[model samples]
Target: MTTQRTITVDQARQIVFDAYTTGLPQAAAAKLLTGQATQAWVTSEYAALRRRGIPAMSGQGSLFDPAAEN
Candidate 1:
């Protein structure tokens, strides 16, 4: 029998952030972050990340934040 480890949303966000900083494509990074290959899952995870203030890319602020554009 095998047991799966469940991570917190913050931990998942960190994983995605680190993956992006390493230059991994979003799709690949999402897969690594979520352990799933479905586009819907990837999209949902990205949206959640955005809502939590994780930038979509390196050296940039959250796109959903208006102040980030300043």
Candidate 2:
């Protein structure tokens, strides 16, 4: 039998960040944090992190990066 540990959302978010710092993809981090791998939740949490000035994704559209000037 396995028992699931109860963790607050903040703790979960920190876990996600820690995973990212260790080179895990945001989706993977989200899965580890929530125990579920779903695009919807990953996307939502990624956006939340971005809103809080954290870059939760990679590439040119990264929220923490400056937008390229045209």
Candidate 3:
């Protein structure tokens, strides 16, 4: 049997930031922090990190190849 952990926002922040350097997604960090990957909270937390001036592990936005069509 496994036990679940209860975490606070500060802990979530730490998980997000530290795990980000390890290529962990916001949802993944949320999972480690809150035991479940909630997109809403993950997104808000990610934005909070950005507001604190922490750059994401990867540059945002991907270069779309318009030439590739279905």
Candidate 4:
């Protein structure tokens, strides 16, 4: 049985990112959000966040990233 994606990939990333910045443990955050706080889920979400160049969920951000500059 396949479960429908209740949240989009973007939603998943934002949810995880918000939890990360708040300093909540990943497991707790995942459970609180998706009902399954598995390491694999967290890892995948984090990877997607980085792939999009979100600058790590360190609670600090800017309109532009110097690292993205060529």
lDDT of 4 by residue, 4-66 (tens): 556766677677888765555667666766654467888777667668875554554422567
Better of 2 and 3 by lDDT: 3
Off by over 4 Å in 3: 34-37, 58-70
* Every model's TM-score: 0.47, 0.50, 0.54, 0.49
* Each model's backbone clash number: 0, 0, 0, 0
TM-score of 1: 0.47
> Looking at candidate 1, what is the lDDT of residue 22?
49
Between prediction 2 and prediction 3, the one with superior TM-score is: 3
Give each prediction's root-mean-square deviation over alpha carbons: 8.4, 8.9, 9.0, 8.4
Predictions in order: lDDT: 0.62, 0.61, 0.66, 0.66
What is the Å distance of residue 27 in model 1 from its true position? 2.0
What digit string (tens of lDDT, one per residue) describes model 1 on residues 1-70?
9676777767776766666544466788676755434456556766676688755565344545688767
What is the per-residue lDDT of model 2 for residues 1-70, given as tens digits with 9 covering 90 to 100? 9877877767766676666445567767666756534557656766676678754344335434566542
What is the alpha-carbon RMSD of candidate 4 to the true structure? 8.4
Worst 10 residues of 2 by lDDT: 55-64
Residue 67, candidate 4: Cα error in Å is: 30
Model 2 stretches astray by more than 4 angstroms: 34-39, 51-70
Model 2 pairs in collision: none
**Alpha carbon RMSD to native, model 2:** 8.9
